[model samples]
Target: MNAARGGGSVENGIANFAPLAATVFLALVMLLPVGTGVANVMMPHFVLIATFYWLLRRPVLMPYGACAAIGFLLDLWLDVPLGLNMLMLLSTRLFILSQIKYLRGQTRLVQWLVFALFTLILYTLSWFAVALAKRDWLPVEPLFTQWLVTTLSYAPVALVIGRLRRVMV
Candidate 1:
């Protein structure tokens, strides 16, 4: 009985981290080499995509603490201002968590619209924050490209996250 209990505990531990593993994998994939080309000019924010996806799908699994930790790591890894990603991610989590009730049973189009709106807000906030921190207005082109690319990439990324959710949940 003790051996059986130990085996179950090990399984539970792995299960608990399944969501984190998947999101972290997606985050790493976002950093893959895409070469110096026009295609790589604008990269989608996969971490944001995955965070929003998991929070919406399984809020119980991806708590605010996990989201904050992921965002903090991203800030450190990317050498951005401390807490910038943390602020953004925590804000996103709060917004979605609060709205989960209304979001339930919604049509796909509605869900996508919500995601698009949040993505736009998230990008805008990042751009504004950077400008404020640097005390200079940055060029609009890069931020625009990133926002566009991320908004467009949402469908595919969300679809992949949905599949992963099935396995993890």
Candidate 2:
């Protein structure tokens, strides 16, 4: 039966979890080792990209609770100050939701531009939070590099997720 009939099916349940599962998989991928060099510095925020794409394309699948859970997991794994990633992700979801009316139907280029701006703000805020927690000002270059890399990576991530969204959701 269909959801409109107030009946749920196994297929519907699996489809609903696809986005969250994909995002969690991405989070695990982010933890894999990358050899030292510029590649390390330029590592894209995989979780952030997935979070953004899912939040934009399927907000219901990526609710605030899921975001918090993902962020908390990242924080524990990465060993950063607790709640930093949570704050960033929650802020991202809130911003996207607020702008959904304007963002919907926009071209990929426009979406990329918006993501760039949003990533910049997120990275800047994260940098400040880390610096404050450590009681020392942190270097800005790596954060800037990560922001650029993450922003640039959004298009491909979005494309893949968009396809998944169509097929699954």
Would you list the C-alpha lDDT of every candidate in the order shown?
0.81, 0.87
Worst 10 residues of 2 by lDDT: 34-43
Give the per-residue lDDT digits (tens) of candidate 1, residues 85-153: 888889988998899999877886788789889878887888889899989999988888887888888
Q: Where is model 2 more than 4 Å wrong at Cα?
A: 1-6, 37-41
lDDT of 2 by residue, 83-106 (tens): 988888899899999998888889
What is the Å distance of residue 38 in model 2 from its true position? 8.9
The C-alpha local distance difference test score for the whole of candidate 2 amounts to: 0.87
- Stretch of 10 with least lDDT, candidate 1: 2-11
Model 1: which residue pairs collide? none
